[model samples]
Target: MPAPTLRLPSGDTWTRAEYEALPDDLPVRVGVVYGELVVKPRPRPIQRRVARRLATRLEDAAPVGWQVDADVDVLLDDDEVEPVELAPDVVVYSSDHDPYERPISADLVTLVVEVVSPFSRRVRPSLYAEAGIRHYWRVETDQTAPAFAIYSYELDDATGLYVATGVHHDRIAVTLPFELDIELKGVREPRRRRRAGR
Candidate 1:
């Protein structure tokens, strides 16, 4: 039998309330982009591991009055009636801001980090850049090995795009928004469970 066809509202835009009403059981991650609904599959285990490690390192190195959080909603355009909201893998924002009370404004965000999954590789960077976020980091992993690469981007105000700042393979050391050094060797693929007998 063919899979049941699901229907969405007939429009190019949806309010935050409408997006929130989506079924919680949906397997994919959902968000609004340019007032349009966008969905992508959840991150695999390897992506999650890398996200966690990077978030931890950022949090530890963050100076007083700064906060590092993973997987939180950020309203990219506060002026738009139906704004674009992105939940980056990790976000660095002011400690005084309350994320739960309302979506964090892009202006308040100091840095955004995305662990590049197959689905997000192309779109996310442009979106963050368009939103005017100052700093962006893209983490890429090799499926065949534990190795990973970190690509840093800084928003170019004149062009409203991100320009590559640096690319680190084994380690990341930067002083932007804060000073920190992180080792990426620990992020690795998950081991498979063995069967009952060989």
Candidate 2:
């Protein structure tokens, strides 16, 4: 008989080494929501491609001192668990700091992006808010409705909840960090279908 795996309580803290030892494989993506583990299926090609594209855009748009990372895990301390692993599709960390194998919190990440799945939606954005991430984007990749929804928030130092600054998209021409303006059309465009009888 196989032994049951022991589960940790909520808000537990674990070291980086301990967090990496958890049994999670690629293609089946995983993240920590509070102290519990959340698994997701691997992203499709379009999603991956779009994420990469966004990374490139941020790189060019960001100021000289900023850096971008794709699908990297940002750690958040949960008392019962070693650390919460949050692997956003795209994240930006300031170049003025050194990188850690496991982040103590989502504060290391200035921005986090997720490409919405066709079926299920991952709750990482809420988790990121809990972990103190500042900016977030929820990408809807459905063929019928392709759009990127941008969200910005101010983190409460005392509460740790991110308060939304009212959602803004490319239409607003909001310039961020590196003096770069993000346009929505770059992320998506309307497709024109041709008539078969034409």
Candidate 3:
């Protein structure tokens, strides 16, 4: 049998309030895209590690008056009745952007990064590009090998889509938003933790 659909007041669509009211026990990460709830399973350890490491590097290299953060909601469209929001793995915005804001407006965002999970590989980059974010990075990890592929993009104003600016395997050097030199080789596999009783 197929899973039951969630019933919203607007039938097929939901407002930000409705999305926020979802049960706290939900097992997956949730966001709203064109009023539809988009769900993806929680990130595995390696994914979290990659996001954390990259955010740290970006924060360390970010220019003064800029901020780099992870897993923060961004309001792409502010339709009062049916909004669109997404939480990229990493987001860079001006230091003056308030953290107290419910959903950070996309206009304040300079760059958004997503470490490609199986689910995000299909949807996120294009969505972010369409929202007119200036820069984006999609990080792809190898399943069997300890390596990662970093695809960098810059917004194409004419097409409202992202144009690939660079693709790096072991390292990345870019001068946009800020000068950044990221070492991808270090973000390969997550460190193993020892058992408590071992």
Per-candidate TM-score against the hidden true structure: 0.82, 0.68, 0.85
Give lDDT per model, in order: 0.80, 0.64, 0.83
The alpha-carbon RMSD values of the candidates against the true structure, listed in the order shown, are: 5.0, 6.3, 4.6
Q: Name the candidate that leads on lDDT.
A: 3
Better of 2 and 3 by lDDT: 3
Least lDDT summed over 10 consecutive residues: which range in candidate 1?
1-10
Best TM-score among the predictions, by candidate number: 3
**How many steric overlaps are in each model, in order?**
0, 10, 0
Rank order (by lDDT, best first): 3, 1, 2
lDDT of 3 by residue, 61-95 (tens): 99998998999888887785677888899999987
Query: Residue 143 lDDT in model 3?
Result: 81
In candidate 3, stretches whose alpha carbon ends up further than 4 angstroms from where it belongs are 1-10, 20-27, 144-147, 190-198
lDDT of 2 by residue, 53-104 (tens): 7788887777766788888777755544445676778888777556555442
Tens digit of lDDT per residue, candidate 1, span 137-198? 98887566355788898988899998899999877899997899987776544547898985
How many Å off is the CA of 184 in candidate 3? 1.7
Q: Candidate 3 at residue 27, lDDT?
A: 49
Question: Could you give me the TM-score of model 3 versus the true structure?
Answer: 0.85
